[model samples]
Target chain A: MNKYLERLYNGLIKENPTFVLMLGMCPTLAVTSSAINGLGMGLSTTVVLVFSNLLISAFRKVIPDGVRMPAFIVVVASLVTVVQFIMQAYTPSLSDSLGVYIPLIVVNCIILGRAESYASKNPVLPSIFDGLGMGLGFTVGLTLIGLFRELLGAGQIFGFQVLSLSWFTPITIFVMAPGAFLVLACLVAVMNIVRKKMDAKGKPLAAPTGCITGDCAGCGMSATCTGKRTADHTVKTE
Target chain B: MKELLLIAIGSAIVNNVVLSQFLGICPFLGVSKKTETAAGMGGAVVFVITIASFVTALIYKFILANEYLLRKGIDLTYLQTIVFILVIAALVQFVEMFLKKSMPSLYQSLGVYLPLITTNCAVLGVALTNVTKEYNILESVVNGLATAVGFLIAIVLMAGLREKIEYNDIPKPFQGTAIVLVTACLMSIAFMGFSGMI
Candidate 1:
């Protein structure tokens, strides 16, 4: 695989920020109430991620380690603001639907995580590819969750009535907050089954535990989880 | 007073920051393994979010408002994201320092989580939501406090459930986040029953 292509594959499959790594749960669960909303949120986040990664990579040498987190945030936040303005002007409905989430993108773990882990260490081009891959993976994850939720919750796909509402009473819960969790849980479990099958076939899976690598710190399982140390040590102060 | 009470209750329950609004989910999931940790995190979140909300509301009203920024011959509304995030980052840092000095043990317990709070979406979500809702300073503070309290409630409950589930015979795949999420789903459903309360 070409290096850039490798980055893409890594993000989309190996370490997918959404399905694989499970970063940015806020937007993953929140905006994914509908297919269209998920796609909009995904693409908007992609643009921010790509540009922020590019800029951070380009300035990796200049950003001091002590203030790096705040600096990365400023970069990501500025890009988000620009994206917000563009969406507000060009796509009013998306802008409105996404609402506070658009601005909240500033705190999205994927963007900052990519910036800290990949972009700041790598050269510009690969970092861009990394961002693109991760963003696409997130988009795919969100869109799938959204599609499932929207179909069941509203008997609609992208606002078109796919399942007739009269014949099928929409399982409205699928589109609500609870629905997001249920769908995500099922999807991840399914993904785990598939990964386990593949691993049994001698294929390399993304992370250990197939799809869900439970980091103790993030999961508050530090007292019980043995995998806590790796995350804490790898985390840079900036 | 009734309206304020309603707003507080509504945010804490009906429009819960975690169960409904889906903010601060990272911490809600991550720091919620233990009830004690969850409680501490909740307290820390309440402090940070309440302060961030108050400060951001002031910034929005006194500085970032269209009328105020227009005086400088620029709309500057476009700067909202950058400005809000910076305020949150700075504010979290300040709080970390204050806690470290003013209350050593509290700071020690919060420890790494204090810095982590800077990126928690709930802090920024409340600030931005407050702006969007056109809330006054008092309202923003109340909303932030209520939201964090809601977060505290959800996380502590989740931690208790998670601890119990640890002993249960769970399926292999659902052992980690999947089961936790499913549990959260049930909790979310339970919280949905509160939606009509307001």
Candidate 2:
């Protein structure tokens, strides 16, 4: 595989930030009440991630080690504010629906995690692709979860009712908080089962254990995956 | 006072910071494997969140929200994300240093978890929520404390549950985080009973 495609595949399947790595669970569970909300949040985050990764990677050498974490955060927070203003102006309802979460994106582990782990180390293009890959992975993960919940919870997919009203009673719990956990847990378990089968066939999605043993070469957090290197953890060590 | 009490209850139980709002889940899942560590992490979160919220509230009320400051062409509201996150980071650092110097044992127990709180969405979420909800300084502080307490309650309860599950014969696939998450789902279902309690 091409290096760029590798980055994309790395984020999408090999080390999916959501399902495989479990990096950004907060937003994955929060804004995924419906398919549209999940898509909106995911795309918005992708925009932020792509740009932040690009900028952070470009300026990697310039940002001082002592204050790199603070610098990365300032960059991400500014990007989030810009995104928030644009969303508020054009997509008022979407903005309102995602409320507080837009700002909370500043704390979303995926962006900062990517910045610290991949973007800050790699070159500009690869970092950008990495961000796009991770963002897409997160988007797909959230959307799938949203699709499941919305279908069961509201008998709708992206506001279009699929199951006729008389056909079944929408399970209200599927749209609630518990449903988020249940769906995520089930999906992850399914993913594990699939991986087991894949491994039996001599294929593996990601390393069996985390980025441990340095097998995860391009991974951003490889330097201090063990959490012992406080200097590498930066600001939001999520 | 009654209103504050209601807000406290509302944040602490009715709309819990963890189960309901889904903030601060990384620490909720990561540090919750052991009961003692969970309690320590909860205490650290409570301390950091309460203080961070208080400081952010004061910054918002006095500097960001001031009409005089706005008239002078300084709009700090746009900087809330950067400001709030920087504040939380600094505050966590301060707490870590203080703990290490004055209470080494406590610091040793809660060492790595302290840094993680800087990124914990609960702290920043409570700070941002305080602003969005139009909470005054006092209300914001109360909300922060209450939210942290809510986090404390949920994580401690999870820790207790996880301890019990250690001995239970569980299926292979669900042995680790999957089973713990399913447990959390059940807990979330149970906590849902608190809806509308306020």
What's each prediction's TM-score? 0.91, 0.91
In order, the Cα lDDT scores of the candidates are 0.82, 0.82
Q: What does candidate 1's lDDT look like per residue over B110-130, in tens digits?
A: 755776677678998998888
Please provide, for model 2 over B1-198, each residue's C-alpha lDDT reduced to its tens digit, 9 standing for 90 to 100. Answer: 998999999999989988988997766766676788889889888888899999999998887777898888888788888889888878887888898899999888776668767767889899999999999989998999999999999999999999999999988777667787798899999988988586
Clashing pairs in 1: A218-B30
True contacts kept of 1: 0.63
Q: Write the per-residue lDDT of candidate 2 for residues A1-238, one digit (tens) a residue.
A: 8999999998898888777666677898889999999999999999999999999999999998877878888999899999999999999999999999999888786787789877888999999999999899989988888898999999999999998889779999989999888887786677778879988999865632222111222233234332232222223223
**DockQ, every prediction:** 0.53, 0.54
Number of the predicted model whose DockQ against the real structure is largest:
2
Q: Model 1 TM-score?
A: 0.91
For residues A1-238, could you state the per-residue lDDT of candidate 1 as single tens digits?
Answer: 8999998998888877777667777888899999999999999999999999999999999998777877888899889988998999999998998899999888777787778767989999999999999899889888887888999899999999999867999998888889988887887787778778988999845552111343333331122222232442232122
Interface RMSDs of the predictions, in order, are 4.5, 4.2
